[model samples]
Target: MGNRTIIPFGPQHPVLPEPIHLDLVLDDETVVEAIPSIGYIHRGLEKLVEKKDYLQYTYVAERICGICSFMHGMGYCMSVESIMGVEIPERAAFLRTMWAELSRLQSHFLWMGLLADAFGFESLFMHAWRVRERILDIFEQTTGGRVIFSVCDIGGVRKDANAQALDKILSVMDTLEAETKELTQVFLNDSSVKHRTCGLGMLSGQDAIALGAVGPMARASGVDLDMRKLGYAAYGKLSFEPVVETAGDCYARTAVRIREIFQSIDLIRQCVRLMPEGDVIVKVKGNPDGEYFTRLEQPRGEVIYYSKANGTKFLDRVRVRTPTFANIPALLETLKGCTLADVPVLILTIDPCISCTER
Candidate 1:
């Protein structure tokens, strides 16, 4: 204990895509305590809601973070729709679900690549991102941008996936899933991954819930609260449950995400089979004059959007509660008594995108 020293891990970590600083107290490669720091990229996006019209704010919402861009847009739209008390067309809801699952698929792939990179698996990292890149290419063709696809509108989606393009997308996803399945063996069977992540950063179900952990973190810890089960958007028509793992270690989290990729593929396939035809979006004519809350299962965890409208183009107030922000307390708790070698891997498993929170 006398030899322990505290070190700053980030705000500009090489392995992390977003800026967040961790104060790690270490003694001979063992972590004694962990402290989290945020607010580096705070853009005050929520405050912008008061200035931008609900229709145009979709683009602003997408900027909350690149990985879960679709979820952010969808969440905002869902909340505002609740205020307006208007139901979107069934076809539009289904379209939102298809794209949301697609967002999750690519997000998990991107996280896998980042996880691989953290463990020094350069080839595996590239391999994972290769699959992610394929998805991004599809996103680009469909929504005109790969990272920040402003595809959601207040009533529904900004654009529709036509039959031919939708079919092509499904075919591409099928091939990607097959390739990803083969790679899963590499993560599960590799001794290096097991040694580094198997027993690292264990989070118990009680602690996860108490700390308000969301998404894969809570699911990995054995809590099964998936917002999709609430039947928002097209998810009500879909049949599935949240994936859970009892171990609550980095290995469990990795397994959960790998399984979710398969699930995403299944979800997209279902959307294609059950998709009906209708207008992609309906014009929202009036201003919001009520308070509403919306939640979604982003690839990282649960995301929340809240809005208060004053019957104007501008909202009275808007608040975004991101998963990474909520998971900070749990992360700090897990780092205690862990080896320094385990620090980066534990953080990677959470896929912390500080931009999602700080903004």
Candidate 2:
């Protein structure tokens, strides 16, 4: 190793939307080491549990990250529910599952577009985002907000999608699937994208496990781990398997996400088809008296939420372990030995969500 030059990669870079700083130690054009630092966007959302009532804290959880807002809220709600011994309605469980999957689909599409843009494929980026718009429109009509849907509550969902509305969502999914196929084709087969991503930022399955990688990052390396299989919410009633790839590279992560989009679409269809008609929410009585921890499979990976209650309106403590936080070490590992030009691609592969990390 010759003279090492430290290059700051982010906190105000065009490639990354959120403010994440990475100090890159470079030897010529290759990255020798990458140390990531993030705190610029820390909102101390978990601390809000002390101020907001247990029921009201769902809103704070939702604001953790706009991209995975639904999952974050759902996780918090589930943790609270477990402590309160509240059982949600069957129909509401199905509704939460469908919405969660829709969030996953939208998140994956957004990531695909960003990945395209990172590699200089602007047209592909536009195409991917255009398809994502359909999902956003559905969210607006169903949840009253496009980004932060304040629909999840302690006992169940605040709103309900009727059968007709559910059918419309399925129709939209059909169209989305058709439109996404074109983008998927480009992402999977295009020579330029393959050259930029395939075999780049490789991590072995063993390394992934050792580094505590989660979500697509671990799944891409053939580590069969998905919190959904734990049967939280309607996942127990749904049938699906975790998408896995053994390549442990950027392309493998891309493939896992792409395949997961289709899987999420299928899951939504199943949820709507078998949904039971009943009240969307139930009455939750008494303050939470115990502590509970819940996990959910987000588009990025598994997120953990810990909640403690003291039989009061306000919770004692709430802690969130976002997926990106868990994957940062793996990200630093991949950055080593990669060409400086490919740094953006590797970062995008993890689908880094700095807002979630700092929250």
Candidate 3:
């Protein structure tokens, strides 16, 4: 093979909102092969688990990725709960589920807005963020934080969803959904947007699975895997199916997330209806004494958190498998055979949260 031009894709770049370096081997404008480098954002959060008590590490988990802060906390809590054999209250499970759906909703909205911004659709970006802010408003009203809603405790949630506040959240969701639909129509029907996105990055089902693709990336490629099927928290009670598209392209990824936002709305409603009246937390008397692995379906995809405790305040080990890190192989494949102009759209489709990946 002739020596291909090597291009470093990130670590710092305007199009990339996070740090992930991809060494792309190219023939003119066509990518031949891609090698990914991570760890730039790693802050030894996992190692910190060995020193900090399980309950006290929620704040540290919140720093894993600011945008996906809640999911990080939930993942860690779920892992520890599994290890401790603590039974969380049903109400606590439902509350956490509602918060999880809200987190997914807002994160997807943020991705949609960033996609618009990538394509220079500034107005669309503003419209998406505007609707997202309404969801964030609901979060702040309930949990007292817009981004890092650290409402999750070790055995349960820290607060309850009051009736008045629930009504307000539902009302806001209804209005936000309506407005979002109106604005999304422009992206869906726009000829230019379609031209730029539709076939830019194509990954077949076999390839997506072989590379261990997760979240929207795998869904777009027609893989039927979803961590929610494992049913942690209240997902077992929620009725819904994963969003899937067989196109295996940028358009399919976009379609999966857009449809998921609507799914999140329905999920939040179900959690509220099924919410049991009880205390939010169950007290734990001692340190965790075993290892546990818990999976969660974050907005990006399936995330797994593993922890090993030694019957002491400090953990023996903690490991996390973030979505973007798992999807990097799929990302490289999509970049191949695509024209230079299609790079941004393809990258955005994976909805790369390299911050989460590197962390």
Q: What is the C-alpha lDDT of each candidate?
A: 0.86, 0.92, 0.85
Q: Of the candidates shown, which would achieve the greatest TM-score relative to the real structure?
A: 2
TM-score order of candidates, top first: 2, 1, 3
Spell out the clash pairs found in candidate 2. 215-301
Residue-wise C-alpha lDDT for candidate 3, range 285-353, written one tens digit per residue = 788899988888999999999898889888888888999878877888888887665667777888888
Each candidate structure's TM-score, on Cα atoms with residue i matched to residue i, is: 0.97, 0.99, 0.96
What shift in Å separates residue 124 of candidate 2 from its native position after superposition? 0.8
* 1 versus 3: better lDDT goes to: 1
RMSD of each: 1.2, 0.8, 1.6
lDDT computed for candidate 2: 0.92
lDDT of 1 by residue, 223-268 (tens): 9978888888988888787888889999999999999999999999
What 10-residue stretch in candidate 1 is worst by lDDT?
A: 47-56
- The regions of model 2 sitting more than 4 angstroms off are none
Top candidate when judged by lDDT against the true structure: 2
Off by over 4 Å in 3: 1-4
Which pairs of residues clash in candidate 3, taking residues 3 or more apart in a chain or in different chains? Answer: 215-301
